[model samples]
Target: MINYSCINQLKTLKDIIRYTTTIFNESDIFFGHGSDNAYDEAVYLILHALNLPDDNLDMFLDANITKNEIRKILYLINKRVTLRIPISYLTEESLLQGYKFYIDKNVIVPRSPISELIQNCLYPWVKNPESITSILDLCTGSGCLAILSALAFQESMLTATDISVEALKIAKKNINYYNLQNRITTINSNLFDDIPIHQYDIIICNPPYVNTQSLNKLPKEYLHEPMIALDGGNDGMDIIKKILKNVKNFLKKEGILVLEIGNEYNNFVKNFQNINPTWVTTINTEKSIMLLNQEQIP
Candidate 1:
């Protein structure tokens, strides 16, 4: 039988995992009435404290963990359980399109489903895609989309534009991290301000689309992210509308624009009652992403 006193002062990886599981169960009561997977969150905290790679937990499931490590992990777990802070902020990293990008409060966590479309190269719509020589990622927070674009389309030149200087700083770090400085250029601009007037073959955006009403309802964990990246005015399509109106000027005749409007799809359609007939909509499990060809715009 395990001694309760000794268990409380765990010294091995095994001990820490066990303790974390226990604390997670106890903490769940505080998280909410019927929360599931609270233990997973606790385990993440443990892995973080150890500075362990994401797969390390699986590799060392039975390995011993030190007592001091248990204490530190427990403290972080408590902070998350009590404060409702997102684990991403604590970890300073997030995954997108199977690639890891460094993250902090300076930029929103990378969680766009647009990754799926990108991975497949926007098939069915983008035939003879060699024509896509230049691509633009507007509102390119953290530069995840831009970096991923370079990785996706090796032959294309990429430009990532953002309005926030702080966001641009984080994006630059990611660009440098991926060593994509040669293929990717970071610009500080509100939409198309700094972007060249020349046409682009593709423009991808996951812009701010959260309406004020929805913003007020966001969980505390979401509040930890940058509001400038989330709030999309009263109807949430303020930025989307602006982009739709001005995007035609920057696109080649055959270029396509892909826009991610999270949770604001209905409002978007309502605002733009006569959406371009050439525009096609793809609904991911989480949201609706619209694609419009340059020729369809005007």
Candidate 2:
């Protein structure tokens, strides 16, 4: 437990950040959502607590903080370290490709690398983003990617599906948040079961790809998220294989499928050797996402 008596000592933003970092280091905290370390996580929580912008952090480093604000900040910091909750869930908001959306335990945090492909308008993969008339966001947890896809492919109408009714409710809220109710529609489906027999120009998905072994050993932060959205069976390809087997049926002759498999690239390649996909790289690394044309599905 954090000593509330020390809250008065954190006068400046820097002081709070330093103190939070020390507390974070002393605790067993995991950092997978956006941040990667204690110092960065401390800064994130502090900035979020102060209701400040994340971009211009340096300007406010010396800003004086009131004791009341300090107490609030320290409480959250302790909650973070002790409870191992993700910062995004604590704030109930998350950013994907600069676009902010409402988030909670109902859906996984929006940190998919596919945001890069959406930002670039699917680029060399699609050649003409204007030609994409229909899109499907399978397993659309929070509708972050679905909304972003709608923004990028302006003319396309989207069908965002999720098996979880709770997740679909959150997705609907996000769609309405972006005022995209006219462009995006939500459906409760187990993959393509509830989807009508309509082929789409593009089918995008960020499904659960964590293998059983990894799921069992996941960090405490992940336990707070929905297990159904993170478990991918024995090899993390259970749902992926199902998609690979039926995606062709839902894609047009010239349509494309953008799928994110996370760290299961090797398993994906080894299993689907016949289907050659263009491994897309984000700003960080490659093999996280793959693009496949209808013809490539055999």
Candidate 3:
């Protein structure tokens, strides 16, 4: 039997991993107490505790670890399981499109599937790829989308706009981290209030679309994140509607608008009649990202 009291006495990576495995086996609180894989979480917690990167653990998996390290890892695990704080929040890091980005309460954890679409340059509905000289990322928390845009389209100029200065600070760190200062510009704007009109070829947004009803129903782990980053108003489309109404003025002819509406697809579709027909809505297995051409705008 693993002694929970002794976990705080561990010192090395090996010892911490062993203790985590033992504790996980004895308790039902593995990986948010769901059927999800706990081993990955255990590994993440252990690596984070050691202040070691994931790659550093491959060589030491079978090696002996110390008591002090086990204790630290256990303490973090206890906080995660009991307090329900997201592991990403605890470690201040998240992986997106093969790169690790620093993250915290300043922004939502990077989990948008749009990264894959951008990398592949596969938004088929787009009319003119070459016309995509400038791209705008609205509601650009952490500026991941804008940073990735600059990296993917080296010739394209990018602008990242967010209402929160704290989120902008984090986004700027990512821009500097990727050495993309020359191609990407960070702006503090609620929406398009400060952006030049008819300038961008593509406008990407992952706005807060969680309606008040849904916001109240979010999991405890989600509650730990900034509410401003998640709450989308009463129907969750308040921000999106505002963007749609004003986006056309900012997009060049043939430009495209991509909006990520996670679970609010139904609400979006319900409001589709209110939206101009020129904008097309695409629904995938996981998300609904709407696309609209500038011509579609009234």
Candidate 4:
């Protein structure tokens, strides 16, 4: 409900950025989709709405904003605050490790710390990235990881699998956008159900590991993502457990499984006491993602 007066108050890009930040800070909005704070998110939204490059805000700060543009940006901000929609969903795009991909409500936003590990090509663990020939990205919503894997392991081929047909559509869209159709393929599968019994050199998954209790307490923004992409049953291990059970069948003898269970580390330890996994430490956390070798699964 932006009126003429409110619109009148914001005339320049800086004004909109300031006002948007103030309102965002004043409101109870969450900010995990991309930016971590109000000011950053505001600048990003303003730059994006203006069709300006997102990286440079100071360059366009004093530029005057027209009334029509102001209304458009204001409407975007209002929807973000009122509906709690993630900015990526609002903008129809997402970034993972600086690589951009088209995004929509059908898929969860790509925020996996695995992107960091991928950028490093699994490094010490995967001593020979060049030797890796096949990769599998499970629960690959929007196919961002599959695309990243293709870029990182240029010599390797990949298969991105998802249970939801709608989600697979987005994944394929991204895969095609990156012009990796020949290297990566999409499969409609309930985990391993429909996937061919081909083994992979690496299998990475940022599956739904939000426990029931945590899912119940998720911010409104998370509710906008598909429940199947977050709800991991009572212990946040429903999908994880299934993944572990069948992983051995799809992984090469020397291959590895990289799983992101997020805060479910404690639950994982409790449930899978027999299997030991190495936690991948991002600059952010030590417990977000875990790695396991083929022998570790059985």
Candidate 5:
């Protein structure tokens, strides 16, 4: 219950940010979508609503904010606290590795560690990016990774697929936003069910790996996203198992697959007792993403 009428009292950007942090903390709000903590989230929300450069927080910390602008910002904060909506959905945009993408309720926010992996072109795994000719991004929400991979491997053509048609619309919108429609194609498929006869140099996926037990403990903010992009069944390997069994067909004999199974490392090992995947090192953790070559699969 934010006192909307008192918004004018918080007149400066600095004032609003402090107030937001206090309010967010008092309300026990969760923050894992875009920003990691309340201070960063406050800065992002206030700066975004004010239509200011996100990086110029220091320059505008004490700058005066108009009453109408304060009202609008307060409205957003209220929605964020009371409704527990993610800041990206509230702002209608998300940033991954400095690249901005349009986001909405149809897809999850662009927060994958794969963004860093792709930004680095997969490092030692793939020494040369130009040699990559094709890429497939499964569960490509908002086309963030698909578009990022296309940018990373300039010579490669990308096919981004998702089971939800509504999610595909957002992905296509983002692809066109980056003017990558020419380099990326959108497919409506459940994993590999409808994928055409094509093998990719790289097959990256950030599928639904949240176990049923963990689903019950998820923060309310996560409920704002499409659950099809989150729920991964009882053991969290429902989609992972399918991908493991069939990804070999879509991956070239010499190619690699980068899969992200957030917080499911133990379950992943137990599910695939025979498979040994090279855990890809990310800023988060090595277990967050895994890399497997063609021979690694059965």
Candidate 6:
């Protein structure tokens, strides 16, 4: 429990940021979602708690906060420290490529670096970005990627699928929130089992690639997220294998598959030795995501 009386003494936004950063450092909470450091996380939490714009952080740095506001901030900060809850779930929102999406424990927080590629419209990878009429976002948790794709490829309609009904529900909420109902469709599918045999010009996924050993070692923050979203089997290639085997059936002759497999680079290379994927580079992590054309898959 947090002591409201003591927190009320912290008058300004700067004061709260410093205090929260200290508590986060002391708690040793994991931070794999977007912000990497304690100070950045503190700034994010404080800004959202105050309903202020992150870009205008400097404008609110020294702004005085009321006792009630301080109490609310402290409560959130304490929950993050003591409970190890992800800050995104605490706020029920997350940002990707400067776009906001609704998030909860029902689906993993939208943290894929693929958002960068979508924002750039997959340029250089796709020969005709404007002609991309159909897209598939497999394992589309909260439909963040699907929504982004809808915006990226204005001519495209998407089929976003996930095995979890709860995740699909959250994905629907996001699709509705973004007013992307016309361009995006959500499906409950185990890989491609429930999805119809439809071809796509592009297929994007940030699937579960965390191996069993890595899953066990994940921080308490991850435990709040669905295990189905993280566990990628013994060697972390179970879901990847299934996707590789069936993806060619749904992709057009020129279609490409973009997949994010975190920290499983070596395993990916070893498992699919015959098939070669053109690895996509992101600003934050190198070789974490890869691209494959329909012809590359056997």
Per-model tally of clashing residue pairs: 7, 0, 9, 0, 0, 0
Q: Candidate 6 residues 197-248, lDDT tens each? A: 9989999999999999999999999999999999999989999999998999
The model with the greater lDDT, 3 or 4, is 4
| lDDT (10s digit) by residue, model 4, range 216-244 | 99999999999999999999999998999
Question: How high is each candidate's TM-score?
Answer: 0.88, 0.94, 0.86, 0.97, 0.97, 0.96
List, residue by residue over 135-237, the lDDT tens digit for candidate 5.
9999998999999999999999999999999889999998998899999999999999999988899999999999999998999999989989999999899
Clash pairs (backbone) in predicted model 2:
none
- True lDDT of residue 232, candidate 1: 95
lDDT of 2: 0.90
Q: Which residue window of length 10 is worst by lDDT in model 1?
A: 27-36
The whole-model lDDT of each prediction reads 0.78, 0.90, 0.75, 0.91, 0.92, 0.90
Candidate with the larger lDDT of 2 and 5: 5
User: For model 2, what is the error of residue 167's alpha carbon versus the real structure, in angstroms, after optimal superposition?
Assistant: 0.9
lDDT of 5: 0.92
Residue pair clashes in candidate 3: 9-67, 10-67, 10-68, 10-69, 11-66, 11-67, 11-68, 11-69, 12-66
Candidate 3: segments with Cα more than 4 A from true spot: 1-4, 8-15, 18-36, 56-58, 126-131, 274-284
Q: Rank the candidates by lDDT, best first.
A: 5, 4, 6, 2, 1, 3
For residues 63-160, could you state the per-residue lDDT of candidate 2 as single tens digits? 99998899888788777878989988988888778888888999998999888889899888788888888999999999999999999999899999
Q: Write the per-residue lDDT of candidate 3 for residues 1-298, one digit (tens) a residue.
A: 2346775466456666666666665665534311246667778777777777787777877665566656556678787777777777888877777777788798998877677667756357654455468999999898888877777666788989999999999998988999888888888998988876656888899999999998987778888788888999988888988988888777877677877887887787787665654333333335466567777655
Ranking by TM-score: 4, 5, 6, 2, 1, 3
**In model 1, what are the clashing residue pairs, if there are any?**
11-65, 11-66, 11-67, 12-64, 12-65, 13-64, 13-65
Candidate 6 wrongly placed segments (more than 4 Å): 1-5
